[model samples]
Structure formats: C-alpha cells, structure tokens
Target: MSPKNLSALNKTHKLLLNKLKDKRTRQIYNKFEKYLNINENFAVAVSGGPDSLALSFLAKIYSIKNLLNVKYFIIDHKLRNNSTLEAKNVQKQLKKFSINLNILKWNGIKPKKNIQSIARDKRYELLLNETKKFKIKNILLGHHLDDLFENFFIRILRGSGLNGLISLDKKTQNNNINIIRPLLNFEKKDLTYISKFIFGFFVEDPSNEDDKFKRVKIRSFLKKLETEGLDKKKFLLTINNLKFSNETIKFYTKKNLLENTYFSEKKKLIILKESFFHHSAEVIFRSFTDVIKIVGKKYYPVRGKKIDSIIQLINNKSYFKVTLGGCVIKKVNQTVIVSKE
Candidate 1:
C-alpha cells in the first residue's frame, strides 16, 4: 500500500474511533462488546433503519478492535418505489466513515400477500449468497429488545408452539451460517439515539407505521400495554424463565437423536430404530425435525402439522414408503430408513 493511502486510512480510523468518546455511546459499546465475543470475520446486514445503522457502526468498531475483516451489505428489496434511492443514500452516508456498503437488489416478482415475510426471506437469500461468496460463516443482524417483545406477541397471536414462541434468540444457525444479534438485549430507543447522533439521520420505512401489517399493529398494542403498566423488566424475566424450560426440551431432543437414530454419512442416509418413536411427543417431534433438517438440507424444518400427520401414518402402517423434505422414508421390518430422494 502507498504511504499516502495508508496515512489517509489511519486518519479516517481515528475519526471513527473518536465517536466512542461520547459517554452514552461508550456505555452502549461496552455493553455491546460484552455480548459480542466473536473472534472471526463477519458480515453485517444494514437496512438503512436506525437499528441496522447502529449495528453497522458497532460491528465496524468491533472489527477494528479485533483486527478482523467485516463486510456490510444492504439488500434493496425493490418492493417499494423509493427503496433503491434509500439504499443508495444509506451507502453514501456510510462512506463518510470509510465503511463501504455493498448494495444487493432483489429482482423478482413481488408478492401480493405476506409481503413482509417474503421480503425477509429474500433478504436472507441475498445475504446468504454473499456469505457463500466470501466464505464467511457469521452474519450480524439488527434485531433489538423491542423486536424480541414484538415477536413474542406475534407468535402468541398466531397460535405458535413453545419452540416458535421463544425462537427469536441472540444466536441461531441458518443452515451453516451463524446469525448473531448482539443488540438483542439493547433497546430500540438507545440504538436510534446512536444512529441519529453519529450519522445525523437514518432512513425510515413507511411499512413500520402502516396499520395493515401485523407487526405495526402489535407495536401500537405494546405501547398501550406500556401505558397500562407493562413492565419490560417483568416481561424479560418471563422470557428468561421460558428459555430455561426450552433448554430442557432441547437437551432431551438431542439425546433422542443421538441415541435412537444413526446417520451414515457415506451413504447419505439416516436409520431410525423402533425405539425412536417411544420417547415423549415433544422429544420425538423435535428429533424428527433435526433429521429432516439434515436430509432436507434446509435451515428451517417442515411445518409441525405435516410432521405430526406423517408420524401418525408411520405408526399405523405395517410397511410404508413416503417422501418428505427431499428425503425418501421407508419402513422395512422393524426399522425405518431415511435417504435423499
């Protein structure tokens, strides 16, 4: 590298680091550092919203401290007319800090219904492709404490299972990609303050306020709850207690998979002993999903209702063959086998 360019880079780094001198931002960084103990290079997903902008800043500072490479990407879903413009504006703003933001556009037919969920899926697809291109294993998200609370209520209204209700976690794996949310414990208001103070302004999404969306409605409902004495501290305590119980279930599910099923990697097959079906319903259900994930090569497993129906068919049949999750399942004698279709 030329000395001139090196000197310019150092100056920009110094300027970026100076932002942490502010007492409030420093406190937030300290708390963020405690949660993010990662040692490897990672990618940050930016949405131009306050939460994501704050994430880009925090992740950039962490990468500088750890001497690890970091990539920032913003996916323009192109769902709205102004999405491309917003993405470009965000990229221009981040450039002042020497943070080069990559813009990825989603080019496909727009969904008429379930737009939010489908757009989220597209964002992950683009981000996952970037990870594969760079061979990076971790992706940092901007989900905050408010998102966690909203997800909880959203799941409840949807009649979600216990697993679904508590699925919004700090760390989760999508296929082999590690999805990390370091700010899951931080409140949205604090993150907004950081973005506003450092970047001067951040883009806003109109969908966030539109009443047609369930999340928007839920956000309003939460504000009402707060006015009616909803204590976040107490709500957080309840979530923690549920997490403890979830862990217990996960332990048994893992045990069931290890003890009752055998995976022949060379054969690309999984063999399930008759005893696999003898465990408690939750354990059996979870164990089946684990196998499906492996054989299906899917990040998320098939829906629970379909799995339950298949389990019933397996139990009632003397001998059967069925296809699910790109896997061919057959019962021979007393053993069940699962292999790729």
Candidate 2:
C-alpha cells in the first residue's frame, strides 16, 4: 500500500476508536444516527454555545466520515441587544468549517413571566418548522450532563416524582420530529474543552448568570454545594435510582392505560378502578395527570391544601368537579373524568 493511503487508513481507525471510547457520546450518536436513518441530510440546532458548538463540530466530522448531509440552524431570538451580531459571528464560525447554515429570526411576542421559557419554545418551533420544510427528520440539541443534574434539582424542588427526576430522554419525539441530544452524556466542562480546542468557540448568555431565573439559582446552589465538598456523584446516583423506580412505575401505568383509558375525538378519559386508585395516592395522581396530558390539557399536581381537596373530591360519594391548572376533574359513577376546563 502507498504511504499516503496507509496514513489515511490509520487516521480512520483512530477516529472509529475515539467514537467508541466515550460511552455517552457513542450511545447518543448511535441512537440518533439510527433514528434519523438518513445518509446525507439532517438539521442541527446551534446557538454557538459551548455545548451546541461542540456538537455541531462533532456532527460535521461525523457527516464527513459517514457520508451524511448536515445543515446548521441558529435562531436569533432578538431578545438580546446583540443577538444579530452574535448570529453573524456564529454563521462565520460555521462557514469556516464548511457547514451550511441558516439564521432564523424570531418576530413573535415574548412571554412576560418567564422570558427564557418563551424563548425556548419559540426556538424549538422555529427549528422544527425549518426541519420539516427541509424534509429533515432529525433535530439535534446540546443538552449535557450538567443540564441533567440541574433539571433533576429543578423538578425535585417543584415536588416532581420519578418522571421529572429522570430528566430528559436521550431521544424523544415532538410533533413527529425526532429530537436528539448527542451531548447528553458529556459534561458542560468537556464541551467547553472541545469548543476551545477544536473551534475556538465560546458563547456568553447574560441570562445564564442572572440569579432571577430558577435554573440560574439552582445552578448557583449546586456550585455552592460542590464547593462545600458535597458528593455530587452520590446525589446523582440517588437521582438515577429514583429514575429507575419511576421507569418501573411508568411501565405499569402504561399497562393501566391499555386496560382502562379510552380516547375519542372530543375527549379522553381514564377509568380509575378502586384497585388502581388504592395502589399509591402519588401514582394515582400521576396517572390522572398523564391522562390529562394525553387529552392535550396541561395539569400540574396540586399541593398542600389543594392536594387534600383533590383527595376529598376523589373519595366523595356524590358528583364533584374542581378546576386545577386549566384541567377539570369530575367524579361521577365511580369514575373520575379528567378533561380540559
């Protein structure tokens, strides 16, 4: 073999080995690549942050080796004063790597209470719209290990059970689109390293540092705990255990859904038998909430006095109805009919 050919083969071998060495990266890439099932076309969501930027670079490299087609998206929320300039910078960086890019402008009204959440919803909407237009089935995100930890804490504080603590799935479907987070296994710090080393890329969002946001506050709290020599690994382990338990509960819940839930064009209802209701009040509440979710109504579990009230309504003999979080729960004829109010 020619020396140049041998050198090229060696490089290819090294690349393949590197992909296998990291379990998280390997798992995400494999799952996404298979889920996408496309040889040469996909859309990547890049905000030029350390996490997104690193994932973009990896996707670019992977595309070249695997004969995949890649397009990059940068959603300019226009909330920040310098958002346009930042988008331009990101475009320039992506161009240097020969990646095709699009900069989407957000012109919709922003939410009043939680600007971050509004921006996120808009961002995904824009990305999914573009992906659908481009006939791309796979959409990539930049969530990492630190994000999982932060979400775990946020859900815990919000009084969430197993589903919330399980955090996000490596791959999930949204509106017939496959959302994949390839960086879920990597830590934010590792992404930072990759960004600096490979692309000389870094992004600063002022909102991330602001203490007003719940996520920001939780991040700061976690950092303080780290400083205090708290075992983050053990904490995360506990969360993982809870997640596993939650998965088991979810399995049985799905079984119950198959057995008891009924869906129609106008409304969906779950028939909570006395046996199922007596399992665990927490599980029963979650099962009810899940039914509401399927019916396209957003419902959060009521707490304290509200929870007591819900329990009373469930146990009452006569018919009763109460509105909670845009959902109406009615008890009639030994069945609780949960629907949108």
Per-model lDDT: 0.90, 0.72
Relative to the unseen true structure, what is the C-alpha lDDT of residue 150 in candidate 1, on a scale of 0 to 100?
97
Candidate 2, 215: how far from true, in Å?
2.3
How well does model 1 score by local distance difference test? 0.90
**Candidate 2 lDDT, 301-325, residue by residue in tens:** 3444464567667777668877765
Off by over 4 Å in 1: 264-268
Task: Give all TM-scores, in the order shown.
Answer: 0.94, 0.74
Once superposed on the true structure, which residue ranges of model 2 sit more than 4 Å away at CA? 1-42, 134-137, 265-279, 297-341
Query: RMSDs, each prediction?
Result: 1.7, 6.3
- Candidate 1 matches the true fold with a TM-score of 0.94
lDDT of 2 at 209: 89
Top candidate by lDDT: 1
Pairs in steric clash, model 2: 40-69
Per-prediction tally of clashes: 0, 1
